[model samples]
Target chain A: MSFFDRFFGKEKKKSAGVAKDRLMIAIAADRENSRIPNLDQMRAEIISVLEKYISIDEIEISKERKGDMDMLEIEVVVKSTG
Target chain B: MGIVFAVISGKGGVGKTTTSANLAIGTAMEGKKTVVVDFDIGQRNLDMILGLENRVVYDITHIMDGEANLSQALIKDKKNENLYFLAASQTKDKSVLERDKVKHLIDDLKENFDYIFLDSPAGIEGGFEHTIHYADNVIVVVNPEVSSIRDADRVIGLVDAKSHKAKAGETVGKFLLINRIDPELIEKNEMIATDDILDILSVTLLGKVPEDKRVIDASNTGKPVILHKESEAGKAYRRISKRLCGEDVPFEDVENAPSKGIMGKIKGLFK
Candidate 1:
């Protein structure tokens, strides 16, 4: 694109980037597994897995018991700079 | 900048606040200017532990909200002139601890204190994140139990993933302070072993505190056990403090303390 077009186009893209983006992740472990992963470890793993695609701005984690299995629900908001 | 340490645990009642109080006083006793902040928010216990509860006119929220300055809010320790205390707000608003505000407060404290100890809340939610966000080192408090060890492991992971040092691609030194260890229970193979806990957590073992009844009495009186020279738990904390200052102190023989009576001998047989 021309210099003038490129300069003016940046503002439009910046506004679009300001829009919020959210990512929800869930991990579960059942009694069949000898060892269940800790919530913090799973959180780091989730961030590393998502790091290849986007940067994380904030994270929220909670636990839910489902039958015989335990689950970790992670909600991460991607960094706007990405 | 001064070192910022967060005394944290995964579960509640694992002695995180107690450790923070003792360690801060321990460091201050060694001639380092120290300040311990109660980051438990609605559940303020550090003030009581340090026996400075009555002196708290303002809290962390007051300072963060500009209602009070850092010096104005800080309570000087009655015994140790070098030690200071910052009480947590009793307000139910747990969300008052914003990341930037927390960092600003810590940075301001670092300018004046040699060691800043953050007494983190029980869970890894709400105030817990902000408490460890600026930590240069973390003291993971655990008990010789399965649940406590598992929770401490989780906390260790969070320290690596969430701290400012971690975000900046730097490492935050992690150490474990195993507390509330019952020697009799361990001799009976009932409680988890110290070696097993260290192996599971994979963090440097700072020290082990024997489960002493004196700790309870000290807490009840709003005094740190470290002040009681006769208490084993108090002595262990003093040694831990010295170790933190890079002193070469020998670890306590918690595993092999001499048996007391017939029941103790029976417990030893199970070992």
Candidate 2:
């Protein structure tokens, strides 16, 4: 910490700390998502198959890591057709 | 058999070529026969860094296409007899580098040298894959910054999933070298601390090179910084080279090291 910052009481968080926090989150997401190939295409295929039966409002696809295995997760919110 | 090290950085201008040149020369000076190959293809610059541009008569592509023999393509270092270089073809298409050909070249290099350093191209496509595909080990060069660290993390994943050893159920050795460290910036909280970077990447620390003007000067003169024994960057590379050979070397405190810049001198007064 600089002398002025220490005396005046620093209010803002350090950029280095902010960078570290951002990197942690970004790297974790990259590790999980980057490993799975054609993720966007796979998500589209799943949405198409689901839309055939249900009125899909929203669909989210993500890859979650459990131990040495990767679990493909697909979450869909269905809409109520009147 | 020779150990192959791919000097890789996912981002450009992060000093992979510089590290490759220094490590090759440093190891060669240790009496180990070392060969540094430029895998950047059309953008080849390792020759310029090693001051071997004029000595290159045949390049790796020339050998791969059966136009020139390995013995002919390998340029013996003028300064260090133990050090050799294989320049990349300046005009060849990057896609022309076939997997089998690269494997053949690496296998040939393994037979002849004790150490083979492949200066990899930046990014994770085309030539980049070919560079790391045959590496027995990797030196991931990164600067203490957000983008560089993030890109290095992504490349680390590929190194594990793509390498020949990884496919063969063996693990490729991974090491991290953080370059261009400025103590003043770290003190001012403008730069990421070395330990923080190490924690994020989770790769074994090789050595931290101080941000030294001598590095740029050395490159401009086509001499690798490792030759300048007085320079801090040179000293850091020397220690890293020792570590590469399994020698126990203590890490110097880069953070507390007395700064030589004008800003550093100004900051020194406050301390």
Candidate 3:
């Protein structure tokens, strides 16, 4: 709700959920049958956005497909500044 | 044998029993008399997952060993009148289950239930085969990651070769359910993208579940995700259930569950 709330990490749970939800749908929608061009688009967009802000550390992409549906888990922890 | 459907995974922790338990509940909720038999003998977590641990006395092993009858061993959900459960023996070795005995047991169950859901063990060998051998369809549970996907791919092959349908010169109708997706990580290229999994597994995707902590809470509380209104996993599972019943339904976007908000949280919180 406020700067204090952000600094204290109270809103972290809620906001993290919101942000994760938005990011997942965008990636899923972009994926063609969850195949290739979509993943390439997702990777490019993520890399560009991260380069704009936090210093990139490492990026690993993994995926799982069920029948005709797809699910992805993305773990991103930024590199610390000195 | 009864129309068996095994909810399997190559690796553990991708929600195999979770899916099987809920699908049992969901199938019963739809008025189909269903029984979810926990075949993960010795592990015995299915009862906890279904919230029926305390009531299980006459387990499947008791019936298989001729110590108890099928009806005597089956535990009714009590909450859903149409649902029943047969727990695995907590003390017996998994070797207690023989292929012929299992076939006979499942055959008796098939005569009684419209759907027989088997919560299979993690591997393809031993009890997993005996459990999977009677299935009409197989739902492969996989998380969107390297280890999980690779294992699921292997398990899919195993199911194809090991299923009863395979013996009849037909492959089991395999469907994939990808679980524990995180949208934020995908946006950062930190996690696997949906596309990569499909490229490797090469199976038809049934549905995708978002990484929702509500699932853990629900599982802990002994309720399935489908029971929660606000759960992305719950809602996704409901959609998957409908698809299994041949109903037309759209899949949930794995990334859009959080903003949809409060309702999912409240639903889980109340449960």
Against the true structure, whose DockQ is highest?
Answer: 2
- Candidate 3 per-residue lDDT over residues B1-271, each given as its tens digit: 3467888898988899888987888778777889999998888888998889889889988988899998889898879999999999788888999999998988888999888988988977677888778888888998866667666766776675577778799768788888888987765345666666665567788888888898789878888788899888788888777777678888767755356366446544443
Clashes found in each candidate (C-alpha, N, C closer than 3 A)? 0, 0, 18
**Listing every candidate in turn, what is its Cα RMSD in Å to the true structure after a full C-alpha superposition?**
18.0, 8.5, 16.1
Residue B248's C-alpha lDDT in candidate 1? 98
CA-lDDT, candidates in order:
0.81, 0.89, 0.78
Compute each candidate's TM-score over C-alphas: 0.77, 0.82, 0.71
- After TM-score superposition, the amount by which residue A3's alpha carbon in candidate 1 deviates from its true location, in angstroms, is 85
Candidate 2, residue A59: lDDT: 88
> Which residue pairs clash within candidate 2?
none
Which residue pairs collide, candidate 1?
none
Tell me the tens digit of each residue's lDDT in model 1 across B1-271.
7899988898899999889999999999999999999998998888888888899999999977889999899999888999999999887578788888899999999999999999999979888898788999998999876567666766776676688788799989899999998887776455777776775667999999999999899999988999999999999999999998889999987766565568556544654
Which window of 10 residues has the lowest lDDT sum in candidate 2 chain A? A1-10
lDDT (tens digit, per residue) of candidate 1 on A1-82: 2344354473243211121110001111212222345756877888889999888898877666778777766689988873
- Cα error, candidate 1, residue B204 (Å): 0.7
Residue-level lDDT tens digits of model 2 in B61-131: 88878899999999999899999999998998787799999999899999999999999999987788987
Off by over 4 Å in 2: A1-7, A37-82, B257-271
For the record, the alpha-carbon RMSD of candidate 2 to the native fold, in angstroms, is: 8.5
**Winning model by lDDT:** 2
